[model samples]
Target: MIEMFGLEALSNSAQAATTVGIVFTEAIALYIGYGAVTQIVHQATREFLGGE
Candidate 1:
């Protein structure tokens, strides 16, 4: 099964590191994306509320 996935070429530690790196990258991307969305929503709310 591992060979079918082409992951058999990688050592166990290498596979583990790759998984961790992928997860970390995804987390950072989500954090930044959510921050931008939250900022946009907050700004829109403030404008609707007549706040400076």
Candidate 2:
């Protein structure tokens, strides 16, 4: 199934490590993205509410 994507045949441990690394990388990316969006919305909301 995996090889169908033209990926090299990695061992089980290697595959697991690769999956974990990919997930960790994506988690960090999503966290940063959401944090930035939240900050922007927070600032906008505060200004709309006339907060200093």
Candidate 3:
């Protein structure tokens, strides 16, 4: 029984770790995507306004 409990705990830990990793990866991707988009928009706005 103890062994089974330990196995279950380990499995849960692994699943949690995987979930965290996926979320972290997605957050980084989004941050990079938004940064790129913001730069594009900023450049476009500057061009539209005829600013240097």
Per-model TM-score on C-alpha atoms: 0.81, 0.85, 0.79
Q: List the residue pairs that clash in candidate 2.
A: none
Per-residue lDDT tens digits of candidate 2, residues 1-52?
Answer: 3355444588888777777787798899999999999999999999999997
What TM-score should be assigned to candidate 3?
Answer: 0.79
Over 1-52, each residue of candidate 3 has an lDDT whose tens digit, in order, gives 3243254455767867766776798899999999999999999999999998
- Comparing 1 and 2 by TM-score, which wins? 2
- Which sequence of candidate numbers ranks them by TM-score, best first? 2, 1, 3
Q: Give the alpha carbon lDDT tens digit for every residue of 1-52 in model 1.
A: 4455577679999877777777798899999999999999999999999998
Ten contiguous residues minimizing lDDT sum, candidate 3: 1-10
Candidate closest to the true structure, highest TM-score? 2
Per-residue lDDT value at 49 in model 3: 100
Q: Which stretches of candidate 2 lie over 4 Å from their true place?
A: 1-8
| Cα lDDT listed for each candidate | 0.85, 0.82, 0.78
**Quality of model 2 by C-alpha lDDT:** 0.82
Q: In candidate 1, what residue range of length 10 has the lowest lDDT sum?
A: 1-10
Model 3 stretches with alpha carbons more than 4 Å out: 1-10
